[model samples]
Target: MRDRFTPLLAAWLRLLEPACVRCRLPADSGLCPACVDALRAFPLPAAAADDPAPVRAGLCWSPACAPLLRRYKFHGDLAAGAALARLVLPELRQAARPELLIPVPLHPARLRRRGHDQALELARLWGRELGLPVAAEALRRVFDSRPQTRLSAAQRRRNLQGAFVARAGLPSSIALVDDVLSTGSTVRAAAAALRTAGVDGIQVWVLARAPGRPTARLGSGHEQVLHEHATEQSGTHRLIGFEGTKAVGGMA
Candidate 1:
């Protein structure tokens, strides 16, 4: 009799659990197992051949992930952000270890509006998990330029000109952390600022890489390896079935 009632008790408990934020299904954790696997299977971005600083991203940006990221970035959903940070840990561990982690700073005005710094939060989460130090104030966004999401590639580069300034006393090697990578403008600008301050060996780590048009110029032979890997995994997005769901509202 006890064994027969165990199944019923488990079903009742599941009904009482909170729903998954991504799929709205019964899940005690913010994300269900299926959603987690789907996100893990997302493709990695093709390495940018032009950028000198090597880039490593946990997953490629797509419609399935846009809502989840928007919720964390725009709506102050710390839970969602924590989930993303957890997902990116494996990629971070496999990359070249850095002495410190520096989060791309937001302009003061933008920080005031958003109420929290998503990049900083992610850096903190990773630092605790990886036992690495984070220098949140090493880099500052001096210029409050327009958002890059709406700008053309050229405009994005122009907007970030002199946008970042790094202070002295930084470590020789560090990884710059951010939520997403689009045209690579933001990290490029940030890396330039770090280089100017005499810091050497910079790497970029982001949660997702937004799909962009192919570039004409290419880097070394390593670019071909990354491109081929990305191409093979390009179809992985089809495994995620969240495309038809209602959009989660947030700024890109």
Candidate 2:
């Protein structure tokens, strides 16, 4: 197989070479040097909510991190997922050898339409790189709801209510993987489901947070919007998904 495919793979690489895997900015060997530092610099634990459960991330949801995730999630860019996974592996390690690395599951309809699960792709790459077991099926999405992107904060919470279920519970410590966390309602809902299944320690791992949205330092204009919406709510956990059962509303 290697002999037969090597030439074709070589041709593809030669044809597609030198595009920065993240921003496609003249690849300086996979990721540019600036992206290298961006990927590795800063302490992720410091940025998370000061809960006992340690949560870590790769980059703040800034302009630097958006392009890559958009490319991978919306444009079907699988390589970007692997590249981003390499960026987040260090933080994943901080969670300490979790019994299972689970990617947030998508509904079957969306998964089929998208032709991929971006989080699952990242989790698989992460598990491979770190030699940890990736449980793509550990948690199942019971609700086939609308995309959280379009819903308001309240609707997001209600939409996701009882949306997840765990088939086989694992250790107290479990790492959940997602591409981006805007309001964190999704992760918290998923975590709540996991908690119901008996897992105690849950840490979320994401590629980016809403820039300057309290949880992370991404430099998007949305930060002001997030801050404004956040003031209305009171709690350590910020609402990433829309609140209220109403279909349309404001976001944080």
Candidate 3:
């Protein structure tokens, strides 16, 4: 049976190649202890303080989180995706008892290029672990939008508008899963689409969030700085301190 073969294959893979799933560092834990700790170190905060949604995130987005996600998404590293999702599961467990799990949908073009949807994979794995139902068809991306990484929060919001729509007959309560949350634009847009379809309650789940990351600016000289922050390409925009604890008055 395929199920029986899975364990045997896993054992063979382990015997033949024993290394951390992401970086390939020597380890039995799938990821090195140091990398595991580093990935797990980021705090998971409520979406908001007083009116927080029934949501939970595993870690904060940083250089480490980005690289792992990029490797899995761009490099076809299924092992790393599973390992990262495993790390994300503990916090996700706190969102217990959802009626269904909906991974954020990707546009057909991106999905075709990547050959897999990382969020859906994570959601399916998480659902299996929690004895919950995974509904990949409940939501769909109706429109393709620009990448959010380069846009400001406002621009990101604009880009994501009308990007998602929930299919008919989805349960009223459910959890939306994704790999990361930058400015919350995509999630919010997806949530809005779900609400429009009569979904009563929605919870957004992401593996990592960029805490206190500034929102998109309207225009003027400030726009350039905002773009730079959002871009924050390698060798730039390192996290110097906690939100509001350092420069930019907590605007990330």
lDDT of each: 0.73, 0.65, 0.66
Task: Give the number of the best model, judged by lDDT.
Answer: 1
TM-score of candidate 2 versus the correct structure, residues matched by position: 0.72
lDDT (10s digit) by residue, model 1, range 1-252: 999999999887666566676887866556789988888675676787876488888877755566677666665666677767777788889999999999999888777666678799888888888889999999999978775544568997998999999998788999999988777888899999999998999999888886564222223332332243223221111112121232332211
Q: Ten residues in a row with the worst lDDT in model 2? A: 242-251
Candidate 1 local Cα displacement, residue 70, angstroms: 0.5
Off by over 4 Å in 2: 1-18, 23-29, 37-53, 212-252
Model 3 reaches what TM-score against the true structure? Answer: 0.74
**What lDDT score goes with residue 138 in model 3?**
84
Error in Å for residue 237 of model 3:
28
TM-score against truth, every candidate? 0.76, 0.72, 0.74
Clash totals in order: 0, 18, 2
Give the per-residue lDDT of model 3 (tens digit) for 188-239.
8888888888887788777676566634322333234234323323321221
| CA RMSD per model (angstroms) | 10.2, 11.7, 12.4
Worst 10 residues of 3 by lDDT: 243-252
Candidate with the larger TM-score of 1 and 2:
1
Per-residue lDDT over 1-252 for candidate 2, one digit per residue giving the tens place of the 0 to 100 score:
889999999776665555556555666445778887775564343444523245567776654555666656654556555567666667667766777788999887666655567788777777777787888888999878665554566787888889999875477778898887776778878898888889987877777665323324444443443343223232222111111111211111
Better of 1 and 3 by TM-score: 1
